[model samples]
Target: MSIVGTEAYPQDICSGGGEMKNLWASQRNNKGAASPLLHSRGGCKGKTQDCSLALSPPLGSVSLKCLPLLEARIVAWIGGPPASGKSTLALRAAQYGFLSADCEPPSSGPDWLSGFGAVGMTNRVLALANASSWLLGATTSGMVVGSCYGEWMPSSPAHIMRVLLLPEQGVYQQRHQQRGSTGWSTDGWRHAYRQYRNSLLVWQRDNGTSIIRIQDRPNETSCPDKTLFDACEGIMAHLDKTPHELCFYCRRTRPPQSAFWLRCPPECLGREGGERGGAGHASHEGASFPGASSPRADSDHSSKVATPAEMEEIKQLLLATQGGRLDRSATHNWRNPSVPGRYGYHSIQIGNVNLVGQRNPNERLNILRSFLNFTGKVVVDLGCNVGGMLHHLAEVKHAYGFEFDPRCVKAATRIAEIFHLPEHFYQANLNTFDPNSTFRGLEHAPDIVFVFNIGSWVGQWQQLYQAIANTGVPMIVLETNNDKEGAPQLRTFRDMGRKVQFISQAKDDVTGNFRRKTYLVTPA
Candidate 1:
């Protein structure tokens, strides 16, 4: 049977575009009986809307059939670099009652959903085919399409409802690279995918597609696709329970989860899980809930941003340093054995791998290490926003942190105490650290120090540069900006030539998106 989606024809329509074809029709002879999923539309161009699903052997016969029926409407595509836990997150959606499908290899995926049904297609390619051809659209039942190529825009005009899933490039690459030995061509496939994604963005803009940009890292249970399904369930439940005039498409008027609408499946009125108590917003309140926070999770205020090339380089450097998996035994991020942490640090999967650099401790360490080397003396985190990076660094030796935000200081100090590290936090801004501020409280002025260079504006950049310059300590800087404009303030450092050397490096992950610079400056 053909794997990728094939174009279909409608009653011999003389339309252009190479005559609507019957590509995968031959495979119908070999397939098993058709799935009895009822559809609002009988068929999309007479194409068999059979649920061609595969279940891993581990899941018994009863579950194989039951799982597909349990999924909700609306399939979401979760895309990022390869091996960025796209499949893992997709399965999590399946576990939570969305008929989930993924493209991971047989070894890692369920046996039932392993083959043709789980054919791997980039977001761009998926967009290239007609949208209604998707299984969810086929049955007129909402489904979650978890994928890593959230960047595709289809030539076929389909509904523009989608959610983007982004994991840290650093952690993603580190995980792949640490996998003993991935094929050398792996990087090439990833580059091609990124290009496809960029094209998708362009297409999205051209077509005026509605984009729901999800910026938060997927917490342990945050299934983007599944959450959407649950939201739909809640809305439907509320509408059925109330006598309100709620539209079938949207249940704004319905009292969500009222008594009347709790029918249990088969019938259009039945609720899949019986009582909708744990299926609504409250059940998903913690970190797993989608759109819990606005998408401005990455605070980008750097004065001098690295070029895309430079950013990719910085990503590579960070990935090289990311060694062992998270010590699951220890309270840290990065638990995958494929992507390990270093000797002096611990891996903590605080958020999704994509958001690791911004939120995950391992990524923070990767960014921080660009400047500080804790070989001789311990390093200090100047602004430990969350103790993610700080806690990992403390594993080495005498790592102290200072947070200007009082709330951050309390949290940082509390976490340090819990982690059994020395309570060393200064709840004051760096401006307050004048000579009179009693360096006595300082836990040995670190031989190395790290600043949150990503959010440093022009003024803060100058202050940090001058401070590092005066101290005569070699430092690393972090920054981010769209490729549209380069940062002017950092241009001066490059103008100095040999005084400040630039080291081209990769962002931790293999995807070429995120890269930064490490300036090796000799004291003037």
Candidate 2:
């Protein structure tokens, strides 16, 4: 319990050291009285019911254990079946400083409050984890980590780590057989496992989590030790860093390639440098495509008869593009996400964000301004979300975008056609993007490639490098987090006998740092 009507706060109950103390003192002084949590030099006869410290994000009564656990930065949810060895691993992990609170109730508490049932146990654990996240959300630093089993999620967007632990099927089956449910038949246990396994696979792809696939070990035995260590290492690697630099992406650590970091023409450097639909491409002004319409933009297409068939086709295409889901799936959240509010690459419209220009807009404006003079050059953007950057550049060059989402493809195509720019947006996973087939039926190979935010994910750098190597594209522009994780991709480009040049730096909205460094790699 927190001490009230006291001048000094206990070091054990609250953290942040001198800084936190000083912050509390300043607030108390401004209020012209000792806060309930802070003791006044002259003790006053006040009731004990006053809240603690009167902080903006109020701190309710907290246990000593939960307060200390706030120091941990990452919360992991480790899921597996019974006797899969995760319980021991979870205990070991908690003993090693990861926090765990058994949701069992006291003897005096009501039976309903005991968390006796399976759903009740899960709910209690979820509540505890979320309460800890609430504390983390209150302060810039400090977190309370947690681990749970079999498909649990904390609603708070604090540092979250999800691990789906899967031992060998034989091992799992053996364990289940040894301890079968009291009323369960042979098929009953098997069916339960299959259901949980399906959900695990679904969430593993859609839910954003660092994965631990514990299969046959060195001795052909399954072990949770190695898997736990790997998960901890990966989780800690991102501790204390800004949400911007994640496992898939990091802010650039050094200056980009020197050759590509040229200053923009005097006009493009200042405040009025770039504007939407500017003077350079005024020949196609007041252009209109009678048949071009978007379902999102023009909601009332029912007035036209043939448009319904077209809309139906678009709907089917979208459904197929979304892997037959009417709504956003969980795996999509994991694929290209590094931040909380901005969960995925296509969240630009939903998240009320300028995914590109949030950080120093001038940095990207500078990059786009440099390509203004090339009218006939081919510019390709891999992983273009909504084609915002390409829309501006399309005014000067022939722009084509390869995106993963059909929804994004449709949105980009509508915007491109509206501007009367010759830009094509196609949906394709950049990791497995085919070069020859992608460039098929075209007259000339792409002169330049735009590799933006997709470099840090699985197979991204390698596949992009392979495509560049195979195509011999002269110049490529991309951004990288300043952290060391991004160095390997640049190194790979250099290793391919390509000369990498530093371009410009942009501010990251998430981290509020100038770590979004851009680079240009050219063939030697």
Candidate 3:
């Protein structure tokens, strides 16, 4: 039997050598139109035009012998975990034949396609959205997108093809810590991984999609070999093929090259004038997925500098500080005089709110201008940390800051008083604040609420929906690191009957460096 997409004749069996050579030749023959999946592999070992050799394609129906790994829009829903190989597997499929679409949710906007270097909570939604969108109204022979499953956006059930990739908890953590990543220190990845796994189980029970274990494959390689054609072959296995019957193609091991660094020790940098590779690539050595990591300690003194080891320490410190409560009163210094340069330098007012310390004068001015255009007087701030945004809102709108952190509430109150803004700053989680308590005044309710990426808390969705349902105010939500967790959080919000109008979600840039993201989500 011959496959529709293949350029060659079908053989009794598909060998790695023939398939790889064919895919390699295909690279140079159709350079521009070549799949992004093939891009990484095509560049490998300088095989510019290796995939063109139409020697032979894999044979045997997916049902006849191989596992029926139907290429039906499989969304991996990859989360931040160790050794999950979400990108590795997804890229392989995309390159081979699986139409892969990478979605960075938190960074959703016109420029959402960029900023997908690391696997985080936000990437899950982005991946889901990209896969789902591709699956929407289109026929997918085989599609695999990897991100966290919880971040999935509800689309037509017919379009979804679910596949779960799980690794051993210990191995996951070991691999994560090895690469200086912060979120998945094995234990954390395991926790989140279990959550994702459980969610997948529930999802599978309701939504039927193929699930295959990497360990079960005939070849030892669970993921596709990262060569141009090898990646494409992995995709072919998923495409319109039966999951259980798809033959596990043998994957040859490539040299352990650094696409980005996981966790290389400082010693890895000290090797003299470069014995094997260039140290210039060291900066990007352990960058999360796609983001580059700067290796030079003095490369950018503007941002807080931490050595690779120091960064690991800092991450450990941050994680250690997670559940600990810091007494605000313990420190006599109420204000951090060293205000970050990232906060645009500008002074703007919205109603009684005056946002001081805006580092960027123009961005602040533009925001104030937009505030005047929409808001008459009332303004609501979601995730109003330290009431900084509220101070700005008070300049034009009757501003109120809603913060869940007690420390932030204290700081916001102080900042509001310091700025002498008439805005009301309250300590409350927007997801769960009581309507009666929050709505004490006869004062005009806010027409626009400002929220910054506070929608990702799965445990708090119900409360958030209730709050929105009760408030009935059109909100402008700004999310930090929106590129990381944008789509998953927003999808949850949308599912709750809250009409969300996307404003913009992109990196919260500071000068030339990337900071976080600002999402302007308004209730439609």
Candidate 4:
């Protein structure tokens, strides 16, 4: 049976275009272009509403009666690029009391003739169609994870909500390139998928799909495995708990309307000339729940600053660097979740991916410029995340960063290589490592040291300072979470006969007040 949704639980449907008529109804003439989106909907044309869904599987495909009512509970349909750890995330998510499955569309061989055009196509289209049916039926109960390919959307839109994983373009390319090592050709489906990838993202915006920016699985490292499985579990738990609502046709989450016998209310269904997109569709009659107000946890922000094309490019660049895994999302803010991505970065412009608030590179660079010229300086940055400050100091002859997270270091290195900058990033336990030892044989000796907003570690500052002091580097730059914390760090440098010059830094993310100050500690 075709998956269908009533306006009462519109948000339950797969993420896509504006509120529409029932899926099985006559298509609307909204002048919108037809997308190759596997999941889709249509405008209602007063079509007859059927209570029992018909799982019309392809030949030799899984049947509708096969949904494991006993085993399967609730499934979330996931959509994103390959190797995005959809299965891994789904499995981890299942730990939160859900049965999950990651589904892959069947692959097919090349149709030699189709490669002549700009957009190459696959000959194995029908197999994918059958797989799509299997995925749809699979979603009838337990959690399901799948990708966004042609003619596929969540088959159980009323129960299966869609989640789109958006990775930085660098991360996307890197992951695929990595798969190349195993001798499996990366050129086939991925190439075509990448071409239309942004379109799917665009469809996400147009229809209000949920977007999650994840980091990539990194290569084997010489250092100890420090990845915090606990933190990730928390993020996943938080995500699963937070509610999201698509503003296009939001309905309160409760008993799904699809379970209701009628599409429209019993009173409205028989009304003259009824349509799903009309006033009767957004009905608020007896739909409210006690203590529950809105479908969205909070109203997420939407930025209008960047043009669509620029936004698309930024999105591609972002996923290319950190797709399929978890990165420090905008502001380290994972408090509230939303349907359309709740981005923390400045929406109007491109900057480094920030874990906290808008730690503007220009602001940091300007603070540096006040104390010393970065031109020809050999810079060593401690606690750098993707090297935002190093990127801002473009005039520096050379830059080296020591970061705790291996993923962050790789991201920083990727940024440097992409921009053709002279920078080196090494994964280091910054808190315990001697700063001089951290850069022992690096391309350039440290002429200046930067310690940006890492006040959370109280005890390590003294050790970090002692290491830097031995390096003959007389200048140290620092930013703090607050002036109260910055005072002590600045005092320690003063006790060492270093003059502290200060500039304003990022605002307190929680309060949106009290901007942190940047300090330049120079040997006096």
The prediction achieving the highest lDDT against the true structure is 2
Which candidate would rank higher by TM-score, 1 or 3? 1
lDDT agreement with native, every candidate: 0.35, 0.42, 0.37, 0.40
lDDT of 4 by residue, 1-524 (tens): 00111012223122221123244233323322232221111111122221011211111111111122213233344545664434434433333333553343223333222321112333222222223223333333444444444223322222234444434456556554554222336575466357447535433432332222233233411000011122122223323333321210112112243322221233212212111111001111212212121111111111112345544544444333333223454222111121133222211112222222233344335334435655556777777655666654534556666666555555555544443344566655555566554455554566788887665443477767766876778688887767677777777777877777764455322234356776777778
Error of 3 at 146 (Å): 47
Ranked candidates, highest lDDT first: 2, 4, 3, 1
Which stretches of candidate 2 lie above 4 Å from their native place?
1-363, 368-373, 508-513
Residue-level lDDT of model 1, residues 81-144, one tens digit each, is 5444445445534544555543222333243332222243322232222232234224334344
Global CA lDDT of candidate 1, please? 0.35
- The whole-model C-alpha lDDT of candidate 2 against the native structure comes to 0.42
Over 4 Å off in model 4, which ranges? 1-357, 505-513
| Deviation (Å) of 231 in candidate 2 | 60
Give candidate 1 misplaced runs (Cα > 4 Å): 1-104, 111-358, 364-373, 431-443, 454-460, 476-486, 492-524
For model 1, where is the 10-residue window of minimal lDDT? 277-286
Q: Which lDDT tens digits does candidate 3 get at residues 181-238?
A: 2433557766656755664444333332322323222232221332222223333444
Is 1 or 2 the stronger prediction by lDDT?
2
